[model samples]
Target: MTASPTAIDPAVTGRAAALDWVELSGYPTRRNEAWRYAPHKKLAELSFGPPVALTTSVPDLGDLIPALDGPRIVVVNGVVNTELSTMTGPTGLHLSSLLDARREQPDRLAVHFDRVKSQISDAYMALNIAFGGDGAVVRVDAGATLEVPIHIVDVEVPDETRNASCTGVVIELGAGSSATVVETRIGVGADFGGSNIRTTITIADDASLEHVLLQNVPASHMHLSNIDVTQGANSKFLARSFNLGASYGRVAYRVDLAGSRAHADLSGLFFGFGDQVLDQQINVVHSAKNCTSRQTYRGVLDDASTGIFNGGIDVLPGADGTDAEQSNKNLILSDRAEVNTQPRLEILADEVACKHGATVGQLDESAMYYMRSRGIPAVEARRLLINGFADQVVDEVSIESVRTWINQRLGHDDV
Candidate 1:
C-alpha cells in the first residue's frame, strides 16, 4: 500500500508544511498519465516502513560503488552515516543535515523547502516528504570552487518486504561557484523492497553544477526518484545519468530556467534486461530570455524488457530567444524487447528554436558483418556496437575517475 494519510498522519511527517496531498488524492495509479506504463499491481504490493538511524555496520561499499576522487557521504538504510562521510570537505564546501539546518539555518532552510515543495507533483514525492527522515543538505559558498566531486552513496539492505528506504537531499550552489556532485545508488533487494529519494537543486547567478546519477539496483526491486532544479541568470547546470537495473524504475526531472542566459543539459542512458521496465519523464521549462536546454537520452533493451522515454520542452510566453533540442533513440536487441519514446515541444514565445526526434531500431547488420570480416566474432561485434551506441552519453561525463568507473561498470573498459 502507498503512504496514505491514514498510514501516518501528516502532522508527524516532518517539520515542514503538512503533506495533505495524500488525503486529497490517494496514491498514483495507471490512470496517472506519468505512470501509465508502470506495473501498478507490484507498486501497490510494496510498503515503506518508518525511517531509522543507521549505525557503523555499513555494507560492502567498495564492491557495490565506484572508487571516485573525492569525499563520500554514505547513506546506509536511509540515514547518512557520519562515521563514513568526510566531515571536512574542500574549501568553502559545507555539509549539514535536516536537524542541523533547522537548528542553525532555520530561515534559509524554510525558504528553500517552501520553494521546492510548491514544485512537487507526484505520489512518490509525497511519500518521500512524509516518511523521509533526517535529510542531507549540501552547500557551496559564493565565488569558491569545490576541489573535487562530492559523492553521495545510498545503499539499502535486503530486509522484510514491508520495509523500504526514504531520504531527501538538498543542494545549493552560491553565485559564481562551481562543483560536481555524483550520486551512486544500489542495493534495492529482489524482494518486494524499494527505495524513494527526492533531490532539489538551486544554482545561483553565474554558478555552475555538474550532476551525475547511477542507479543499478536488483532485477526485481522498485526504484523511484524525483529531481527538481532551478537555475539563475547565466547559470549552467549539466546532468549525466545511467540507469542500469530496476524492476520498476522511474526517474523524473523538472528543470526551470528562471533567468536569462541560463543553460540546462541532460544526457542519460538506460540499459534494461530480463523483465525490467525503465521510464523517464523530463520537463524543461524556459521562462526566461536567451536560455538554452538540451535533452539526449538513449535506451538499450535486451531480453523481454521494456523502455519508455516521455520528454517535453516548454517555452512560455515572453520567453524569447529560447533554444531547445531533444532527442531519444532506442536499440532493440531481442524480438520481445519493447520501446516507447516521445519527445515533444510546446513553444508560446517569439524567436524560439525548438526541435525534437525519437527513433527505435535494431543493430546495424552491415556494421556487424564489417566487424566479423575483420577476425572479430559475431558476438564480440554486437557487443562493440552496443558500447559505441552507449558511449555517446558516457563520453560526456567529463571527470576521468568517474568516467573510468562508469566504463568498468558498463563492461566497456579494457583490461
Candidate 2:
C-alpha cells in the first residue's frame, strides 16, 4: 500500500512534484514577457543530458579563484568536491551537501524546493529541483556574528560528449545573526556543457547579510541561474554582482521584502565583448510597510556583443511607506554593439515612493579629445573611460580581493 502524506519521504515527494511540474510546464518561449529579451535560439539549442560524476582529476583555477581567507565550499558539475572544500574559523556556521541533507535531514531542501516552485514555475527551476541531488547547504545560527566571509565556488567541467548539469544552493541566517557570503561560478574548458543552478536565501528578523556573485564561465558555455530571496523584519540585504563572461549567460533575481523596516541594497555590472550575450533580470516586491529597495546596474558592451537589463519594482496594496529606486546605464564601445534596458515601477499603494530611469549612450567624444590632447593615448583614454563607467558599481563591492578580481575580469588593472 502507498504511504500517507505524513509518512511520505520528503526527497521522493519533492522529486515527484518536480517531475509533475516538468511534464506540465515546458520551457519558456519568446512570447513570455519575462523571456522576451532572452536569446531564445541559444536557449533552445541547449542540450541537458544527465548529470556526470567527476571521474578525472580537477584542473587548476589559475587566477580564476579569488584570494580569500575564509570558510570555503566548492561544487563541481552539480556535485560537491570535498577535496577542494574547507570549513574553518567560524563557529555556529554549518555546511553540508544536498545529498547528505536529503539522506539525514530531508526537510531542509524539500521546503525550499516547494517554496521556489510556489514562487516560480520554470523549466530550469524544475530541472534543478528534479536533478539537484548534490550541491552546498549553508546555515548560520541565531545571534552568531561571523567576521570572515564564506566563499562558495561552482566549477563546470565540459564532458566529452557535451552534456548538462543542474545544482542547488540554499543559505539561511537566523535572527540577530550577521555574515558575508561570496559566490563564484567559472568553467574549465572552451567546450563547456550548459549548467543550470538555483539559489534560495532566507534572512530572519533583525539579521544582516552581505553577498557577492561573480560569473565568468568559459566562452562556449551557457550559464543560467535563478536566485530567490526573502527578508524578515528589520533585516538588511546588500549584494554586489558581476557577469563578465559566458557565451550565453543570464541571472534572474526575485526578492520579497516581507517584513516592516526591511531594506535591500543591490547593484551589478555586466561587461560583454566578443559576440557574447549577457542578460540580467531583477524583480523586487515590497510586501510590508516601510520597506525599501534600490537597484543600480551598468552594462559595457564592445565588439558585436549584446546586453539587456530588465528591472522592476512592485509595491503591494498594503505596503504603504515603501520606497524603491532603480537605475540602468549602458555604454556601447563598438558600432555593432547593442543594449536593451528597461526599468519600470508598479504601485498599488497610495503612500509610497518609486522612481526608475534608463540611459543608453556612447563614450563622450569631447572627453576623449581632451584626454588625447593631454598626452593620453587613444586606446588608454578609451580604457580609462570605460573603467570609470564600470567603477561606479565595482566600487560598491566591500571586499578588496573581490574588487581586484572583478577589475581583472573587466581588463582594468586597478579600481
Tens digits of lDDT, candidate 2, 150-212: 888999887665656777788899998999989899988767577888888999999999988
Stretches of model 1 off by over 4 angstroms after superposition: 1-18, 52-56, 115-118
Candidate 2 segments exceeding 4 Å error: 1-10
Error of 1 at 209 (Å): 0.5
Model 1 C-alpha lDDT per residue in residues 1-415, reported as the tens digit of each score: 2333333332352423325665666677878777889998887777754554333356667757777777777776676778877756888898866545655775776544453445558766776776666457889999989878888887766455545677777899999999999988787445557778788899999999999988877766688888889999999999998888679877888999999999999999989888899998899999999999999999999999899898989999999999999999999999999998987689999999998999999999999999999999998999999999988898899887777777788889542
| Best model per lDDT | 2
Clashing pairs in 2: none
lDDT of 2 at 13: 62
Which residue pairs in candidate 1 collide?
Answer: none
Of candidate 2, the 10-residue stretch with the lowest lDDT total is 1-10
Q: Against the unseen true structure, what C-alpha lDDT does each candidate score?
A: 0.80, 0.83
